[model samples]
Target: MEPIQHKIYHVDSFHSRTFLDTYCAKKPEMDLGEECLRLTMEELHYFFKFANIKGGTLIDISIGPIIFHLYSACECFKEIILLRFNDHCIIELKKWLHDRTGAFDWTHALSFVAEKEGISELSEEKDMRLKAAIKHVVKCYDDRENITDPLVLPPADCVLVTNVLDVISKDKVDFIRNLQKFTKLLKPGGQFLLYGALNATYYIVGKDKFHLFNYNENFIRKAIEQEGFVINHCQVRPRKTESDLTDFKAIIFVSAYKN
Candidate 1:
């Protein structure tokens, strides 16, 4: 199948609600809950392990509205900055933080994270902490200019970039270029948390298919090293279910430091 003609930086069809309801939403009848639980554990294990790393500022450069990984770092970092590709994502984030009507509830995921961390509290308590921890949500992308050139923000101690490179890049060169740009946002020796699908060509969202530049562990390691990052931790999980939402044999997580 031909790839999506336009570069998709964020999920377009159902807005943030589409993503929230489809993946992050907690419905008793949903069959994908186990899959979601497994995926969250796979990704959050690294965050939980690396939470003690010295990082006063954290940056998340992910697409869509999911904030599953950020909760782990809330207690470890003083500030959290969310950078997205468009205004839609920014607005979605605001709606949640500001108590706007029609906002997708993320209490289920927040409570899950807190519980995993041994915190005995409702999701609302976690939500308030997360909201206060998040300092800003701004528009950002690495395509128009060098990744380092676009954002004039402070260098982050830890940068979370997940499921971004593959969908936004046209090919390997483009992916590598963007990777280097993202790394430049970090201070030297800062941690770079990354996650992506292995060999996934496309993923569906509300009947719309988005491209994922197929890559493997070898490619990821090479790209990180070439971009001046030292790999400290890595994990891979095999596909848990057969679903058209995404096609990939494995999900890979990497915790690296800027060298």
Candidate 2:
């Protein structure tokens, strides 16, 4: 296997290696493709049950063009908004997805992840097969406007802020704080669906900062509760990894109400 090396950071190299190796061995069908779809639909269903978001508007903070595709197809949204911090994730993402589309292409999207993660072309076949499951369900846009920042998309009925609360490890506290502040963008009584890798430690491809953070159901439920939201349901799943190690579960998905 081609090695994708990073600066010798704080990660437990030995454990990381064994972990990655193990997951690689039993690569399952419910990989990122299945996982993301499951996560997205779960978010959709949650808002439907606890909030009055249907046929209204929707905002996906820190999401991408892919979500617009989802809403467009469902015709369940009055409008769709995609927001992100102004950065290369947007720049490069725009360049890579320069073609216009009304459908979210999961394959191209996952390819971006595979490439961003530095997996060599030689390993593409493996990832491609796993990505195929979800790729078939999504499509994205080519317009640069889709990737712009400080973007206030169409007013939304529900907001999906998934796995974005944890970015830089060193400032994780502040990151969560900022995420809390960001949540105000939602209208009163709007629905907020949150997801995060409770203890994720990965880098933004090519960037030096190691993004890491941890959160459990109780931890997140309490954190968000103070902010005027009531949890309707929550699920914690072992983050899907290519590693075979058995102990590092990394995600919590929360479906909550914004009061």
Q: TM-score each candidate.
A: 0.89, 0.57
lDDT of prediction 2 = 0.46
> Of the candidates shown, which would achieve the greatest lDDT relative to the real structure?
1
Q: Compared with the true structure, what per-residue lDDT tens digits does model 1 show for residues 55-117? A: 689988876766766777776789998877756667888988788998877767776776677
Candidate 2 Cα outliers beyond 4 Å, as residue runs: 1-32, 36-52, 63-74, 92-155, 168-172, 203-209, 244-248
Worst 10 residues of 1 by lDDT: 6-15
lDDT of 2 by residue, 119-186 (tens): 67634453323322121111222123342333434434566765545542234355556556556556
Question: Model 1 lDDT vs. the true structure?
Answer: 0.75
Off by over 4 Å in 1: 1-7, 10-14, 28-32, 35-38, 41-46, 49-51, 146-151
Error of 1 at 156 (Å): 0.7
Each model's C-alpha lDDT?
Answer: 0.75, 0.46
